[model samples]
Target chain A: MDKIEEKELWPEEKSLMKAEISRRKFITSATLAALGLAMTPYATLAAAPSNKPVNFASFVEINTTINGQNMKMKLDPRTSLLDLLREQLGLTGSKKGCNQGACGACTVHMGKDRINSCLTLAAQIDGKEVTTIEGIGSETEFHPIQVAFMEHDGYQCGYCTPGQIMSAIKVLEEDHAGSDAEIREWMSGNICRCGAYKGIVEAVKSVRDETYDKKLIKRTQQKVS
Target chain B: MNPFQYSKAKSADAAINGYMEHDNTAYLAGGTNLVDRIRRDVTHPDYLIDVSELPFSKIEKIEGGLRLGAMASNSDTADDENVKNDYPIVSEAILLGATDQLRNKATNGGNLMQRTRCSYYMSPHFACNKREPGSGCDAIDGHNRILSVLGTSEKCIASYPSDMCTALAALDAVVQIQTPNGGKRSLPLVDFRRLPGDSPEIDTNLKEGELITSIDLPESSKAFAKASHYLKVRDRHSYAFALVSVAAALVMENNMIKDARMALGSVAAKPWRDQEAEAMFIGKKPSRELFEKIAEKTMEGAKGYGENDFKIELGKRAIVKAFMKVAGLS
Candidate 1:
């Protein structure tokens, strides 16, 4: 969980910083100033003397609920939410296909809405709740969307399934899955290179129809209390 | 991505102060485009001032139209009852671009401030004046199928890449800004983005250390609210950048155009709006012949490089199609 300590840096990170400072050709006093800034826990890396003094934090501590588990950790400001979930928390259900937002392979639910975990920084989720693919269903029992994907043969390579399923759940919840065309348009963000569009559309369509039917079927006549 | 300092600001003034105090700083909002560019090494910031939590996330109904908070997510802004009902073009444009997850994370202000998606500008290997001031522009001679056709200079030809801003231009939206000296100012969204002239590095008129607080949609545009259409033509039907797009709105009265607003996207340095040309549609009736003439007038001086010459014709067709849809004609 500890990537780099705040006050006492890991030996490797310390060596890296020393190498960086030496490469920058700073004067001995400036090197001391840089090391001094590093030693001061959570201090931003000091730049050249001419630059303005930066007061930003290098280490950000966040308290967030990830996959239904509360976690409090100090993370590097550069760590993304996807990296935090996959590397630090050991939840790799969210795949990082394109680290950028272009690929929906890193899709996850942040609270009630879906977001690209790769684009979200760990610090941004300080007080928020995040749900990865692992958080969606049990081992013995899969979520309805997962079941629908299996039944409908929604995936080919299975690499993009987690992201597709995550996106599909929101598409259905948003009532955007009224038809196959609508599903394709709404799920456009998540690209499946396997060209499994036919199955993905069918899986979402089947679930959407079932969800609508359940609203009427599951409605039990309320008896007077 | 480069190692950088990051901090969350609690207020607008604090955010501005944080930005002003740093030698090289960027205000992090949605992080949808900023984070991606950081990963691509196209943009490098020494310090990131997180203004996402600055309490500017409201989408309030103003006296005439709506006051969209700068921090409001694009998804929330697009799905708002008022935005969907009164500003349907904005909603449609936002939905047409980006995916559901991106829409949820990209903020309204960040959408306005997003950099160009030009291949030359995005990669460090290529020469882009926008990325580096003195560096020559590779897109001028390279594969510029997606580059701008109008308002382009020899220095840069990158096209502005926001469908939402294209719609806002038609609506005549005003961007409210918080200056670094604790003052506030507002400019029309049309004037907010600058054409890539001698200095392509400067994207907007926003000065250094200033923050955008909100965007105002005026009441005057409400007339076009119902009869507006956003037509985007891209390589893919969804989740792709527009090759040529148009935002057209008409306040029609008894089969006659009372007033009209039109703006073209992905064809110019900024959203290409010719108010002088649009004025021609004010007194005319809806006709295919009239729409054709207006489309031609819109693309009068649009010049294209090798791979993007098709954009001129595509832009004209998109403009006419958007007009036809808004006019409720075939």
Candidate 2:
């Protein structure tokens, strides 16, 4: 892991870190006040502020189940789910393309529904289940969707592959991959700047067809039994 | 992003009080738009009141129609059996917007409260009157290919960018709001959003600390229930804002139009509905020619900005297309 030394901090970086510390201190005092402690601690801290200007906001502790693992983390109220996933949890499989909802590169599963992690607040996921691309499959074994994408050459740059796969899995789960047109419309949110949409669509269709055939085989076997 | 105080409100009263106690406080639900705006530094609320956990997430069938809770996810509402079977236009409109991912996170009230996607309004680099009142609007002469043409004022010309709201306007839905004083009031969807006028900063008629509770859709005739349609023409097939969209519902009796409701989007500050044009269809036989005439009447006084002049024609065709679809002509 890369670490930044205190002496190597840039002028702006140092100021930002100072502000962050002060903000954390203020949050600690505010939390105590909310717990029936007197507000004197918060008032004194606000009045005794140091050289660096600090805009203190409350920090929220979120208990979320990510990748089937229950974890609790204190997050700034403004932290987005994408930042919490990549920066704090070190799960960087979900790439941030456009932080705005315009691009779906940061797609992940919240329960059964896929959501743009960049647009979702980290605090909003309290007590919710989050599934990132890393959780979709293991390094030793690939999910069928990942294997299908590899077999069909579904990506070029691979920057958006994680989001594409996440969205595709949800597409099949939602029963929206019934036809080529349906696949295209359902997967339209995850944009591939490489213009590998033709192969992407082919991969999704192949998975859908394979899954359907397997279902048929299982049904026939059940009937025979 | 600017740091702001955050609190999770346990009840509706707590949410309202949290907002009213602060000068610049915003209710947080879904956070799809509010978070994005905060990241861009376009909106800087001093405090955030989390209302996502409030008991406003149900979609129930009322005595007359459907009542959609404010916090109900757009995907759930669109996929509801009742909405899909009875108000399919609303379902179609909701599905046409954003994506499956956005629909899952976006709540009904959040969708209604979403700000315009106009480049000038969203980007802080440009002067946007809607962002900073009296600062001046750069889109008035700047790049306005996606701005509104109807109901635009010189002060601002941002288009309302919600497909669900467009359908709600055509459906004559009512917005239920919880006043700060613990009172409740209802406003029709059409009257819920306001025109740009001089104060473009004010997007809706919602007052400070007034929380949107639910939206109610009134019962309509079977003809309207069966013959409603939403048509959106955009730069792409999906995941794009509408260049011009239309939501039309009609009731036909004996080959004559008995009633009609039409509302347009991306052409005004709010859903642009021409009641006069809708009234013109009553007692008249539905035809392409009549639809064209009605479209023309609806586009009257629609002055477009330089780049968006094509919307005048595109909006007309979209209205006609929607009408044709509802009439089962095409």
Docking class of 1: incorrect
**lDDT per residue, candidate 1, A1-225, as tens digits?**
224353443322343344454544334323454465432211223322334433345688899998888989988888999998889888887998978787799999998999999999999999999989998876445677887787778899998899999999999998999888899988988989998889899889878776422333222445333
Judging by DockQ against the true structure, name the best candidate.
2
Worst 10 residues of 1 chain B by lDDT: B119-128
Q: What is the C-alpha RMSD of each candidate to the true structure, in Å?
A: 11.7, 12.0
Clash pairs for candidate 1: none
**Alpha-carbon DockQ of candidate 2:** 0.24
Per-residue CA lDDT of model 1 for B1-330, tens digit only, reads 677788999889888998998988999999999998887777889889999988999999878779999999999999999888888999999999889899999999999899998876776644679999987776776568889999999899999979999999989999999998889999999999999889999999999998999999987888887799999999987889999889999998888899999988888778878988899898789988899998888889888898899999888888888888888886
**Candidate 2 lDDT, tens digit per residue, B1-330?**
777778888999999998988989999999889988888777888789999889999999998889999999999999999888888889999999999999999999998899998866776545678998987777777558888999999999999989999999999899999998889999999998999999999999999899999999987633478789999999988889899999999888999999999999889999988889999999999889999999999999899878899999998898888888888899
TM-score of each: 0.87, 0.87
**Candidate 1 residue spans exceeding 4 A from truth:** A1-57, A211-225
The true-structure Cα RMSD of candidate 1 reads 11.7
Residue-wise C-alpha lDDT for candidate 2, range A1-225, written one tens digit per residue: 135575643222333344465555545543554475532211132122234333443788889999999998888887899999999899998999988887799999998899999999898899899999989866445677887787778999999999999999999888999888999999999999999888888888888888422322211222221
Off by over 4 Å in 2: A1-57, A211-225, B221-223
Worst 10 residues of 2 chain B by lDDT: B119-128
